[model samples]
Target: MTKLYTICFLLLIMAFGFLTDAAASESSFVDEIKNTNERFDTRAVPLARQVTEESVLAMEEYQGGSFRVLARKKSIERYRCSRCHTGKPVTAAQGLELTHGNIALAHGTEGPGLTCIDCHHAQERDYLEDKKGRKIDFDHSYQLCGQCHFRQKRDWLGGAHGKRVSNWAGERVVYNCTSCHNPHSPRFAKRFPATYSVPLD
Candidate 1:
């Protein structure tokens, strides 16, 4: 073949190889996200299913944020509350209603209260980020919920809320929003009495 023709052939071969590599790389990246989501689903699905059991009661009709229990009542994979609300997995939101359903918190609180994401930054995108550029997913049950309930959060952290879940020789660890309040309207503690009460002697 002529020298110029041979050069042209080599150039074409190089372009083809580059394109193939790029496509393969993109495919792998998408696959990685899928696998990660699947693993997330495996851990989350059972927890979410438990939220729907008869033991848990519906908190309210409000629907906004990452996961809406009212919407989830229809189907698991079908619910799309995540389109607007970011962070925290979809399943976590689903669990909020049942895992931490509270009867009184929803109606009391003195006025129309806030939604779960109002304080909690599920993806950590709304919250303060780490120096490493990693946005820590705020467990709505604690970190995010603490933003507003400073005194209560402090009390909870110091072995005051319910019982302290702590390690020996370590500071106390408190539960997040999901631990107590359902994400729907009338936010309150799932475990506590809906209305406030004096501690028993």
Candidate 2:
């Protein structure tokens, strides 16, 4: 009985030895595959580097020439960032302190409520109209303002708010109302001058 038990233990040891040899053989095979892959990559390294260099050069050329010109055209407009909003004056009124452009009045830290994108949506065009013939034309300045300022428009229509200078007999093209009153800094009575005097100056 003891001899049979010893034979069974020897058979188990032989099975473990075979399993160990199989695992070592798999590990060696994987190492050889990795080494071959590394050698192939080394051979191709110069070609890969040349491709990368050409791509970078092409990118730089495109950015320097066409991209820069397009950026300048888009950015340097009549009313770049500060037209309706009053942080900076528009180009036409650059040096002037109190521009006809929208700025604040009657309070601390006030100006035009219009945002950059508010007027310049839909492919940076200020005006766009749909199929319904309900037109949106910002270049016709008063209409651009009239769209959002319904309350003011109502008053203008009812003859209560806006200043009516001369009753025209012809096609009544009124003044650019935004010229007199800043939509961002609306006033109740005509208290200050048309141009504001900076408090420090």
Candidate 3:
């Protein structure tokens, strides 16, 4: 029985040794294949050269404002409101401050008691918050506005409302609600047309 046990132990040890050797061989084989592929890739593809000032200028010359449409978010000088209001929490009592005192809330005749946080996200100052508390990007702010003003949203989508940028023949890039109408005071301010000179003799 002792002799049998000794033989079984010896067989087990041999099996473990074989497995370890096989694993090591497999790992080495994989590593070799990886190294070979890496070497081939390196040789096949040339390293990209650093873009110089002259190259940049040349590229800029070729690139025109043909396809690119001007986004209103880019025009906003003070976009990130949280930069100043980082520590400050938005409150109703905090009325109109010195920073945004001039903002007239003349959007809806009955749309009173509306605060900044009503549209703007509390956590994300850059994004607008929907009724469902979903973060809407400043670029796609129309989505947030669409929640209440579904008619205008549909009109804008159907190319009825809002001004379309550049050529109307190709890609249609229209201005957002915030572009024409201020988020705080969405009503288009009453502006009188310039008087025309009489051409009668």
Candidate 4:
């Protein structure tokens, strides 16, 4: 009977000790909650302000000084277009398809349909020519696009349209228009909404 009492008493003491420790922990946690204003200052947190080298491709100056843009000519498959172009006119014979037969020209609107030679330089296959016959580098193709899309160009220059590849607090690396939109089509394809609606019975 004494052994049973001793075991029961020890168990009760242990339970009380555990409860006390738990209560003390809760009390400390509550005290911590009460002292919330004395916590570490958010302003002291370090921020990533510098843009990494990989984040930039090429930098150009606009009205707001220098900004970065993704390189266009670097991304092209057959970049230095002079390889097979040969600067000769492509006159197709009966049943003879041109080399770039895959490129379906869907760029312009109502008119006598725009041919490849209209935008591309006839004599210089490596360059795109403006309406004034000035040579435009593939990297600066935005100049050609801006000839018609002046409004969007204006917005792009003003940082209203287009996107910046850099984060909130780094070098301003703006994306070229061709980054998001296809130069040939430019129209964004219709995509399904992210949130699926509940099925109505």
Candidate 5:
């Protein structure tokens, strides 16, 4: 009986030792995997270069140049307004009631008293007419707008009004008044402000 008990105790001790060894081997394997993953992550990440003011200035100097404003007439997809109105004459008394019903001439301080022929050339139909009846190309529509709103034109030329193309430091290619303001209804409609993601409080 004593010998049997001693054998059982020895067997229990051996089982415990095997379990501990297995546990130790598993721990080492996990640590090795973790180290390999860390090494791979470090190798995969790219190093970012430091951006300096001098580098930015140098880049600006390289790309900087004078650029002319893009012509609006060339940009217009549907420029066939004159195609239909070539033979037909727009009377100042009748106004644009039949065809131009979609157009809401709510622009300018003059109100509804203003007519289509006031700005548009009645004779040419293709080109815009200034207050002096001079034919102004659609590309140079700014000249026609400047005839009445000289102050706005001056501000637009000085870079106060309208959006600029590309960067502000580079070429000064600006959009015409017609780009932002609609020729028919220049007044912008009122709307609710956009919702913020971050809490104000």
Candidate 6:
């Protein structure tokens, strides 16, 4: 009986050794497959890990932790809207094609819907307006967005909604609404996954 037990144990050890070899080969194969996949090519791209306070960024203090968001005032292309938005401000209902050129406003529901004037100050072309009739700075457009998307705002404040800066540590810098969502057309269209696994070649 003891001899039979010893034989069974030896067989079990042999099976484990074989499985170990198979697993090691499978792991290497998976590693090679992953290395061949080139989803995002950031080899030559340069990205800043920590943004300074001087740059177009705003330091935010929340209950969870503190972080920074990109400021819009200076970074905006056609900033100081007073530059060309002079005279009567062009409304979205107007000839947006002629004035803004290809700004398709497709958000909001019927009746008392989202219009340029709803968010943007009627007179101040640069500053945004909240539901409370307060002027929101271009840097803090998140405030204006929060009026409608309270849940998302809450999640963002709690570090759940938006993504943090890429490969970040120490001082956390998170992306705001405008970073991912287009204020004009907030909803995202269907798209392919950023990455996926492929069969070994």
Please tell me which predicted candidate would have the highest TM-score against the true structure. Answer: 4
In model 2, which runs have C-alpha deviations exceeding 4 angstroms?
1-114, 126-135, 168-171, 183-201
Clashing residue pairs, backbone N/CA/C < 3 A, model 5: none
Give candidate 2's error at residue 6 in angstroms.
99
Candidate 4, position 186, lDDT: 71
Q: What lDDT would candidate 3 get against the real structure?
A: 0.67
What are the TM-scores, per candidate, against the unseen true structure?
0.29, 0.30, 0.55, 0.64, 0.55, 0.62
A best-first ranking of the candidates according to their lDDT comes to 6, 4, 5, 3, 2, 1
**How would you encode candidate 1's per-residue C-alpha lDDT over 131-152 as one tens digit per residue?**
3433434332344345556686
What is the lDDT for 38 in model 2?
Answer: 45
Model 2 agreement with the true structure over 1-201: per-residue lDDT tens digits: 999999999999999999999999999999989878444455544421111111111111211131100111122244543345554435764654554344443322346544434444434344433333344443343444566676875565444655433343322223344446544454556576888877994
Instruction: Put down candidate 4 lDDT per residue, 26-141, tens digits, no spaces.
Output: 99999989988877788885543554433344434668677766667776676677886774665656322555555666778568767778778888878889899999777667
| Sort by TM-score, top down from the best | 4, 6, 5, 3, 2, 1
The lDDT, on a scale of 0 to 1, for candidate 4 is: 0.74
Candidate 4 global Cα RMSD: 7.4
Residues 43-127, model 3: lDDT tens digits: 5644433222111111011122322223556657777766766767557565446567777765556846677788888877888
TM-score of 4: 0.64
Off by over 4 Å in 6: 1-48, 52-60, 88-96, 110-112, 192-201
Q: Which digits, one per residue and each the tens of the lDDT, describe model 5 over residues 136-168?
A: 777667778788788987677677767665455
Q: Per-residue lDDT for 47-75 in model 6, tens only?
A: 54556533234445688555677655665
Query: What pairs collide in candidate 6?
Result: none
73, model 1: CA deviation in Å?
A: 18
Give me the runs in candidate 5 sitting further than 4 Å from their true place.
1-67, 74-78, 88-99, 109-112, 195-201
Each prediction's RMSD over C-alphas, in Å, is: 25.1, 25.5, 24.3, 7.4, 13.2, 13.1
How high a TM-score does candidate 6 get? 0.62
Show the colliding residue pairs in model 1.
87-123, 105-186, 106-186, 140-177, 141-176, 141-177, 141-178, 142-176, 142-177, 180-190
lDDT of 2 at 82: 35
